[model samples]
Target: MIGFGLRLTLRGGREAAVRLVVTAAAVALGVGLILVTLAGINGVDAQNARYAWLNSGVTDATSPTAEPSPDPLWGMLGADIHDGARITRVDVAATGPRSPVPPGIPRLPGPGQYYASPALGALLDSVPAAELGARYPGRRVGTIGAAALPSPDSMIIIVGRTAEELARTPGAAKITSIATRSPGDCTGCRFGLNADVLGLILAVTSAALLFPMLIFIGTATRLSAARREQRFAAMRLVGATPRQVSVVSAVESTVAAAAGTVAGFGLFLLLRIPLADVPFTGEPFAPGDLSLTPVDVLLVAVGVPLAAAVAARIALRRVRISPLGVSRRITPRPPRAYRLIPLVLGVGELAYFVGRRPDTTNGQILAYISGILLMMAGLLIAGPWLTMAGSRIMARRARRPVTLIAARRLADDPRAGFRAVSGLVLALFVTSTAVGVMTTMIAERGVPDAGPAARGTLMVDLSRGEAERGAPEASGAPVPDRVLAGLRSAPGVRGVTVIHTNPLGTMVPVGRWHMEAGLVACEQFAGMPGFGRCAPGAVAASVPPHFGAFDTSASSAWSRTVWPAAAISAERLRDLPAQGVLVRTDGSRQAIERTRTALAAAFPDPRWPPTTVAEAGADAENARILAGFQQLAGVVTVVSLCIAGCSLAVSVVAGLNDRKRAFSLLRLAGVELGTLRRVVVLESTVPLLIAAVVAAGSGFLAARLFLEAQLQYALRPPGAGYYVMVGAGLAVSLGVIASTLPLLRRVTGPETARNE
Candidate 1:
């Protein structure tokens, strides 16, 4: 029976070929996107491990025990690289350069001479290499290899000299104790599910993408199902059994899917090249990072065709392949209102959580998780019901023949209409949720602070306190007052402000507070609401004081406890006891460079180096982490969207032939072409419009509830432009149905109308 099925499909020739190609193309695209996602994950994880090892200041052959004894390698082995105060991760490898470098970067700094990578070299380009010796402590000769890196766009700097000459110089960034000696070649050694939060993020993201893949496959499999049903019904009239017909349908879908999956793999490989160049997870991918893993390959090879077969079987179960059944218009029972139970449950969960004080109790966590699950499940469960309801209402209100025809078809099998958009609804819902949560988190917590440094002010924290917090591999310690005094006397002799801890490690007092709180010094009233008073010596608090709970008992809690306060500034930080110092330098870049040099030169030894901050990338961990999630969401959304788009296109084309007879009869009965076009357009546009509206509203509500539950009451919704973009994308997707309108002309021609 299956062999017979295959022959019948193949014998259908050009018509069969076209259907198979469309189905295959849809499958190929879905599978390809999934593969690309896998590559991204692998690349990010690989880069993380590489950077981790780089920051540990260790490499394969570096002897760990060899210390300051004369034979020492004085160059930096692996060091925590930074851009301004914020760490850019990007490693600095102190190894012999095998690849040639640009003429701009000098030879491995001979003890004091420094050469920069192309990226680093660009930053130092403004300063003359000869003049750099005084402030930078190294004469930059040239830049590192312009093309050596796997991610040519990476900011890797490799600078070192021959063993004998390098040994002469000492104490630069000597590779200290090795943290990891194992080379990162073994895939088995990599972190897996044990990554916890990271793992959950990837798994959930992958699952999100997988849904659209399935939707695409399912939609493509059912394409032309109406025509297939009719053909099989004719077969049934010739004494073919139901079982044989089922086997034929399965065989047909499976062949197309298997071919598509293979093509998809090739497409993925082609795409990986461009995707690798894209900066994601804070870095561009290494050469092989975007390639599929063995497991991913195996899964694609086996799973895609199998899924196709299963989907085909499922599509068949909806309609009987018999002459009598096919001749009769059979309407399946409309999905009931009860189908909305999951959505209702999800909303209830959200309400429960949103009403309570945000806390991390076990119950609260459970509620959050339950809410997420229920929301997703609810969309799936409610989709068909919503489709049916809309169809019924549209049919009821239909006064024209074209509208009536579209409505009746939809009302008959709303499941088919829902199938086209289920993936899109889920994608939008999840993406909006993530964006909303991030906005809330960012708004509530504010940005990670590195004390106060006004723009155009050169801030140098000689204490190394800020660097130590973010950069684990930093060896620099606190600098003494004498060095700071030297920095103040440097050529850029603009007044320098410094903060010092008393011998007791406590922040020095600026002055007594003059506000109602009687707080002494600006430190005591940090970020206090409604307080704009500057402290003595112009010093202020680095972090705002946490005002206690809002109590309604006192003064009826009518008046606000505090009002918005002026932010701490460099002026306010002038005379405070500080662990760090902020400098007000002239606008000249040379002056800034001179100040940085003076700060570094102030440190007689590398042990207690003074660090200078120009501009931090606002690239703190929270922001970076959130950005990663956003990037993932963006990737998944785009892929899901493409798959959804294809699914709809295939869906419309598949059903066009099925509606030919109805359209022909309607045309015969005096329906206008414009009215028929309107019907074709409405059939798809209305359901999609419903999906977009529902998804946007539901996703927003769910995200809002989550934000409230998390204690982030200051809700910052994603940009209003998100809706505009979504609407535009939806409009484009819905336009695909327009292509089917041309087919209407042929199907409803006088010849076809008379034949039907």
Candidate 2:
């Protein structure tokens, strides 16, 4: 009996060609998407592993600050990020743990001994001998390992020394931390041996995206189920046992699914080849990192076929197939209120998330992830129910015969109708959620939140050593006196507030004790706690507990803050105890440029970087990150749309011959050609429109809940552009469904009715 069933399955392939092709395609697409996601993650981790020492970690040899920098990773290289990495001073330091030295670079034996990379050693060699020792204070012992080098052109240097001799060295430590860590590698996967927020996020996003495509794939498999049931019933009447019929059904689906799964693997491999060049975290991916393990590939190869066979069995459970009743088989009275259970559960989870927002803890992250998962699951589970309800509502209000037919068909079999639109709904939901997320993200970092300078304020300051390092043998660096003079003469100069550090190393009598202070002079200082800002004549001192070790409190005009001491003019700098001027200009770009030119003329070779408060390109890195995520999301959406189009086309075109009898009967009973066309159109479109509304609503809700659960109350709705995109997508879907309507006229012809 099984052999007979298998024979029938093989012979019937041509008859079920459309179903076979679409089902296989569905499986292939789903499998391919998942594989690609895995490859990307593995690739990123792999790249890190290949250059483990570089990303292994880095240490800062700087002293502790009262307040930490906002994000240290960003300010890692030179202070002037605009120049990328054109630094004159090689920030090399050592005397720590003996990390694996690169092959070319030898280990240093003691303190005051150094092993520099060839690139760095040359730069040090260029410095004058008299100043070199004072600036670097180390003997070049050997070269660094070439393997440890980031690149031949890198401006960085790592000065390694034996820790035994450096422990006793005073003031030898500062803020030191790892550069590139390998925590992502301990388990050879980004997910670790366990789950983490970053990993969970990646998983959730993949699942959210691919599940819609899966629905389309499932629909493809089931597109001709009605006709397949009729054939099986005929076989049952011919003395074939139910078991034999089941075997045939299973064989057909399994083969199609298996074929599609294999195709998916092929697709994944093709995709993997090019993606290796794509950058992640500012580095290209290694090909090996993007490949799946042999075990993983094997599992996918086996699991997808088995799952398809299982789905085939489940699809046959609802209907009682008998030769006589095959044409009039009953569908279970549409999915009921039970279908709403998932939606109910999702709402409850949403409430829970709102009540207790997620924190940095693993439990919170899990809960947050779970909440999102629930929201996604609810939409999937409730799709049929929503479709059913909408159909019933439409059927009751339907005025035309064609509308009534469409309404009733959907009301009776919303599961089928829902399947047709489910993939698109999921895509739309995810896109909308992304919109909300990105909107909030962009809004938060709208403008660079650098210290003190409000809108339209232009600030210029000189570094401490800018005076002594006047550009190599070319006259002298710009003096504060000339800079202030230029600023005063510049056009559109609204106002100028000059603040310079106290050069006299002033001490004010505080009752019994005279407290030493480094003062900044601001004519009108805007107060910064502990580091004062006030009127022009006010002096604000950022009195340190001990300021001798680190005086780089105000390192650059942009990176840190320098405060006012007693307000003094540049003219009084010689008389008043002081440092170079910290000028704040209340003017336009024209005025700032004029001042820059004037300062350049006054000091022949100034080493200072004169910058402004106006922010531009501050969020470039963040924008790139956002764009990458959006690009991924956009691809998912497009794929979902293609799958949706395929699903709709299959539903409309696949079973025309089988549906001919029913379509003909209606025509014989006085149904006009236009009426039948309307029926076809309504059957496809109502469910589509209904699914769209529900998907959009669910997506918005999820995003809103995400914001609240994460406790980020900032709300930014997806703009009209998002809606336009969704609308355009739906229009295309509608157009595709409509294109298939012409087939109804051919199938419902007088000739078809007479023959049947």
Candidate 3:
């Protein structure tokens, strides 16, 4: 029986190679995304783990604060981050195995160190532990508490010869204490191995896998119903049980799925080299353990077949209405089932929307899922109506003989019409998503005005020594004064805000601290000369809605009793104030408390002291960092889009198989191959055009809401290019489909239809 089944499968598969190829490719595309996404998460997690290991495990470095200047890494090249190494200073209570402390008030194992000026400056500058010996003749060492500071907020303690010497090192060293770090911008070293990346990967990968599974099973069931009607009918005529027929159908699906998995795994291994280059941070690298584990292979091998079996079983339910009543076409179902589906889907969507408010994350997820289901259900329920409309529209433009015939076909079989439309579903979903994401990003935070075009420029103050090494002819690179002067004098130069952004704490008005967990963005001070509107009273607001969080009830500006009137963005601002607290760079609560203390300490001074802008353009260092981050985000988006394109390849091939018969008929009727190919291209282009329009509309609406709700309080409106992401996305989608045009000519000759 197995041998017979195998032989039957091969014979059937050869006849249906085109369909199988497309279906298998789609399956492979889906699987590849799964593996790549998993690998990416692993890579990010591993990198971050390495960073955390270096930061959290070390005793000499803990809860570091911002530096006045950049530091050298590994005692050689300059890096903006505080330490080339993680430094922690643990306070060991058990003095039994005590390591000797250098000369200080007491030889206690609590945090203390000996270091020179340069090394001390470097250590105190950022979160990573500074190179102590580089500054002083003696090496600095210390112990920290078991509880280390959170990443991005962890401070790099400077262990000079004496506490007084460390205090006199420059900025306040006491701020390095866990109680003093800021909550905002505190990624610390832990950011290098972000668990959130893994979470995101899992979420996206699930959708990626499930979506293809849906498409594959849907198309396969439909095709099986169409092509295998004769075979199933004959079996039914020969006294085959309905159950037996169902089993055969399930077996066929399993065979197709297994073949796809094998092909997919092979392709994954073959493409490992290029896939490794997808991540921006690493060199071209593949995982040493590239192959799937036996368990993973088994899960895939079993799970896919089971999914196919389930789909086949469901489809077979419709086939069992009357096993003996066989026909070439299914009689139309009563409108009850078709109409009821829309109502159920619509009500489910409405219920989801109403039950879950858009103001919460749960609500947002509900809204998104509900929206997708409702749209799909509406499309399916209204398929015939849509087809009628499309046919009419095409009929009006069907001056050409071929287009007239195509329109007639569309008007006759709405099911087949939708198959022509299915190609656009993925394109539209991805394009809409891409547009929405990019538009929101662009509108909320305008592109960097690289030149009237330049948004702002930062003047970094390089150490005089480093500057001298770079340019011996120039005097001390006291960049704050020179760069400021140059920027002010340059044409097309707008306003300037010498603000600071780091994974560190800043003083705020309230006594409590808040965390700026993701990143720190410092822009022009409000009302700075040539900059946009900024009042001394206006503060930078980083509210919750800006971070893609659903809550938007928080006030755009807050009044800090300590700082008087200042606006600040919450690392996680929400409608619920009690749930919200003051934030710091490291996402630690201490920064808020410290902010209050700092504000109280510096109150009534003419200039806001602690958080005030230093000399003009002193924040050039921060500008460089923000630029680097933006660049990285852009690179990652481009790479992911490329991955998405590969999925489209599978989609296009599937679409081609559905149209092969029609194309072959056209060829037999003496239509030129080139014209047939163009028609195929035209078929793809039309749907994509419609999808582009829809996606653009969706993106613009979303962007508008995002900008108004989240960004307008702090930034200006977006530029023209901000809206252009849709066009760009459509172009890329079309380009992918266009590349597959050659397949249309495969059936152009006279023998094409006979083979079928």
Candidate 4:
């Protein structure tokens, strides 16, 4: 039976060689996507792992044998501690770049002070260093922590050492500044099972897999079943049992499955190398990283065949209705069951989810899952209705004869219409997804807040406790103090406040996690220009203090601990004290206020007006990152749109092939050659315009959904880039159709009839 089945399958496939090849290519593409997806997940995970390792020190460096080096900015990497080293922490106030003061208080000076041990301070004054002006450039600063300063501490600077000695010494002065950054928390997975990165990979992979898999299976089964119609009828006439014939059919399908399985697995192995280098690798497989466990290999080798067998078994049902069955194909339904099952499942699951955990990650995951599934169901249910409605609408108003014929053809076969257009739907889903993410990121871009001025920031470097007078006029420019006075005397300058910035790292305990608390101090914004405004005592914070919690390679803790809750410029609330005890200074809170007030009064000329005070660090790197994100989205959308256009062209040509007889009959009825060509163009154009209209509407809706949340605080809607993108997509599709018109004319000629 199996041998006979194999022979029959091979014979059947011979008649559909072109189709089989196309199906194989589709299957191969699907399988390749699966591999690529797995690889991408691995790559993203690996990258996140590296970042987490670097941030959390969960993994030790691989090259510990290399000589420890000193960092000019961060100080020595490896250094010993020294006893009785009178080390101190200091703040620095350097003259800032020349720029217009905006409408708010200027930012507190950034940390740039030099710190030192008492012994090093005395050496800086006595050195040949004095000849090159090696004196400390900030206010007198004192020590804070009790532990004797580490050798690498800038405050514990070694005096009588040459540059060579500094490099050779294993235990040089070390700076002991605790980082304010928090570590990753594995316990608190940010998005839970709705992992954004994972979901993104899954969406892309599933789309790639489903389309090709369905198309391959559908075409393969139809061709096989159609060819065997007569043979199966003969078997039935000979009194062969329906079950026997069904078994034989299953066997034939098994043969096809085997061939396809072999082809797919072979392709997987062949492309494994180049797949590694593909852009946006879903999950990466390094050369040796093609790690398949015994179980995995068994699954791949044996499992793939079983999956194919199942598909074949299901398909064999169509062949079961006695070889003499009248209909060779299943009539297309509205997919009501597809729509209903998900709706029922989604409703139940959603109800349970909301009742159990309404606002948690679990709830969010359930919501996302239900919404996406419902969307799929809705699309299926709506597809037939839309196709029928579109067909009628076009046929009613179609002015061109070709348009009328195309519309009637579509109305007669909504099933084929739906299937062919499914490619467009897939393309839109991907394009919209890419756009949504890209736009989400782009909307985040903005002018960084410039903080209050620091004309009298009282810069102090504890590492080299030698204070010097200001060089405000050093570079042939007006003295900064003088400039400050001039600005204060100008129109917009308000209350003069002298703010001090001292980099302080605090320890925070949230839930089960221990995290570092980084603090920056400045008066908040009171007003601003075209953008928006801000005030003193207001602090703004990043969404999460530590971006580290997303790493799964570290702790197995059950939840992330929230820590150091403060915005970049959140207003200092009434409950919190306005002033706290200074770190190393010996003074009461009142005394501290007194000192601050005195300084503010003395430095009236250096006061940064409200215009210059920005709450956030306005760095160039942030802008660059945002730009890169938006650019990537644009590229993906353009590529997908182009692919979609090509796919549409192929479908149009295929439909034309299916309709050749109809076209010939019209020609025989005296349709002119030019009129026939015009009809062909009209047919393709109606559908293209319909698709374009729907696509444009969908893209607009997608953009609105994406930007709505971000625009709550801002005024302008994000500009309509998607409109331009949709227009581009339409133009490309129309261009391809128009270009193919001449070739289409030849298909209706006498030579074409002989070939057919």
Leading candidate by TM-score: 1
lDDT per residue as tens, model 3, 132-184: 22221334454222122222223333233333333333222222112222212
RMSD of model 2 against the true structure? 10.1
Q: Cα deviation in Å at residue 564, candidate 4?
A: 31
What does the lDDT read for residue 405 in candidate 3? Answer: 59
Query: How does each model score on TM-score?
Result: 0.73, 0.70, 0.54, 0.52
Per-prediction CA RMSD (Å): 8.7, 10.1, 14.3, 16.5
Kindly list the per-residue Cα lDDT of model 1 for residues 638-748, writing each as its tens digit: 766666777787777767667777777877788888888887787787778777778777878888887776674755867776667686678778777787688778767
lDDT of 2 by residue, 56-174 (tens): 22332111242333322111111221112222222223434432233345542344665565655675576443322223346767766544443343333444333443333332322
Q: Per-residue lDDT tens digits of candidate 4, residues 1-756?
A: 667766665665544454345444444444444444454444444333322211111113212342322322111221111121222222212122331111111322233333344445554455343211132234324321212221112233211223343343332323222221212234321111212534364454455335435444544444434335557767777887777777676675555555666676677678667644432322222343333345544555565445555654564464466555634544445333344454345334434443344465545544544544453444444555566677889899988777787777667766556544444554555456456645555445533322122211111111111111222211111113443354334333333221212123345443367555323232221211111122333352112122222221222231232223344333332122111111111223222222333323332211110111111122223454355445545544654564455455555555555556556666667887777676666555655555545544444343443334223222233357766776677777777767767765665666555554
CA shift at 162, candidate 2, in angstroms? 13
Looking at candidate 2, the ten consecutive residues that score lowest on lDDT are 73-82
TM-score of 2: 0.70
lDDT for each of the candidates? 0.58, 0.57, 0.41, 0.41
Choose the strongest candidate by lDDT. 1
- Candidate 4 residues lying further than 4 Å off, grouped into runs, are 1-15, 45-358, 445-666, 669-688, 695-756
